[model samples]
Target: MTTLPAPLVWTFDGPFERCLADIEDTLRRAIVMVGDVSRVAMLIDLSLPALKQRVDAGEALQPAWGRFLERMARYGLPASPRVRHLRGAGPLATLVIAYRN
Candidate 1:
């Protein structure tokens, strides 16, 4: 039996745009550490209210999100990542969990 490494987790609580660079960097590092991108799975948690507010205020999230997906694809991660929005009240928060699947 082989032992797998623990998941890589990252939590972002700020403007979505501001954290893109950091998020990409983290993904890159994770790919390097795991040695196999296909074995990785990602979970993203975003504050519902904050996201609504941004959308209501005419902020476009699709472009940024597209870029993120592109980065993941480039890193050999899955193109279709599972997204679940949970009810919550707080500032913008993005949680990413990457682990061997």
Candidate 2:
């Protein structure tokens, strides 16, 4: 029997590009720490209201999100990550992502 490492959780509340950079750095460090990138699984948590606000504010979140996923794929992670939306979280937008094996 093999036990998996604890999941790596990250919270983002800023521009999409910075978020992507942070996530990318986290993934790189995690992969190096685990020494096996293939066993990693990613979970992305997005706020529905926040996303809508971004769109209403004239920010292209959808396309940016898509591009972020594409960047993750380049690191050998899954392009299609599991996502969950939380309601009544508040006005501040937050993106939470978890990587696990």
Candidate 3:
């Protein structure tokens, strides 16, 4: 019997607006790297409200995540992003990505 490791998830906790940039940067790198691989298959779970607070704070969520989503879509991979609104939190963000080879 063998065990498989869970997919990689980047957690940039702290502040949404303040940490949005960092999340974008991290996701970009992962997407680029995974896209270049021989077998292009990846999974991402961005279902945390805390992760989206920054963009949801009147920051045009679509444009904010446009590049990364476009890249993932172009690569023909499945990116499941779960975004929601939550009250209370000071500029905290996080990015989580999963890939399978």
Candidate 4:
């Protein structure tokens, strides 16, 4: 069996308010760099309780990731984020943005 190489991952550690801008900037730069790419996956790791609760409540992800999604849409990148709960590191919420060809 052949194992695929890991996708590029960016970590933003800090309060959401403090790190949101950095995350946005990084994502924008990445989208620009990967122009016309065959595929791209942008995964977001959010482990905050507040965010987790909001997601769990079935509230629109817009509250948490609206801005990012909006930006991606502007670039003609539609996002379908799959949320997963990672148990190892305190209730972590993972959003995987998979871009397909």
Candidate 5:
């Protein structure tokens, strides 16, 4: 398989909504640096239950995620990409964006 370029990594913390805002801000900044974005790898550091709790508590920050995904879809990336959960010693969440160029 062809290897994609190293992604632009973005770390997020604090309240879920705040974190999502950070992601959105970073994504906007990244566009300036990397041009158009095609794919993104979202790494959630929290476990499934922890994530569920955030979602149940209206803290999943779906709006930010939705906006990001919507942007990706406009770039021709599939609306439903394969998602995987990984455990790693990193920030609470990380968004790795790959530029289309």
Candidate 6:
């Protein structure tokens, strides 16, 4: 019989340490705000410009993609204390995580 807060969204511009840090921070904050009854929805994808820029900056998509998936594996993406990846967007390597805490 209570209304929940609106969903929190975190967008990553690049797959850099700083950007990833921001995402972790935001996700944590959302969990805290919602507590054991929080509902969350996340959409992480590679923008065209961002994708091209990283490649131009000498960042390969495979390695970067691997880095992301590796982090998910380490943190247990589909489990507690981690974001749950709901659906596969495409070969574009989008990570859309949704869950309720």
Clashing pairs in 6: none
Task: Tell me the whole-model lDDT of each prediction, alpha carbons only.
Answer: 0.69, 0.63, 0.49, 0.51, 0.55, 0.51
Off by over 4 Å in 3: 1-6, 36-80, 84-91
Best-fitting candidate, scored by TM-score: 1
For candidate 1, which ten residues in a row score worst on lDDT?
A: 91-100
- Stretches of candidate 6 off by over 4 Å are 1-5, 62-64, 73-101
Which scores greater on TM-score, model 1 or model 2? 1
Report the lDDT tens digits of candidate 6 across residue range 1-101.
45454544446554554455566566556555655423545556545655566578876656545565566445333443333332433222243445563
lDDT of 4 by residue, 3-100 (tens): 32345456554444435556666656665555543366566666656555545766555444667555555644444433444435442333343444
Worst lDDT window (10 residues) for model 4?
Answer: 90-99
> Model 5, 37: alpha-carbon shift in Å?
4.2
- Number of clashing residue pairs, candidate 3: 5
Give residue 100's lDDT in candidate 2 (0 to 100).
53
TM-score: model 2 vs. ground truth:
0.69
- TM-score, cand. 6 vs. native: 0.51
Error in Å for residue 47 of model 4: 2.2
Give candidate 5 regions above 4 Å deviation: 1-5, 37-83, 87-90
Which 10 consecutive positions of candidate 6 have the poorest summed lDDT?
Answer: 84-93
Query: What value of lDDT does candidate 6 attain over all alpha carbons?
Result: 0.51
TM-score order of candidates, best first?
1, 2, 5, 4, 6, 3
> Residue-wise lDDT of candidate 1 within 1-101, one digit each (tens)?
45545666676656667566677777677766777878777766677987788778787787888888776677666645566686796656554656655
Which structure is stronger by TM-score: 4 or 6?
4
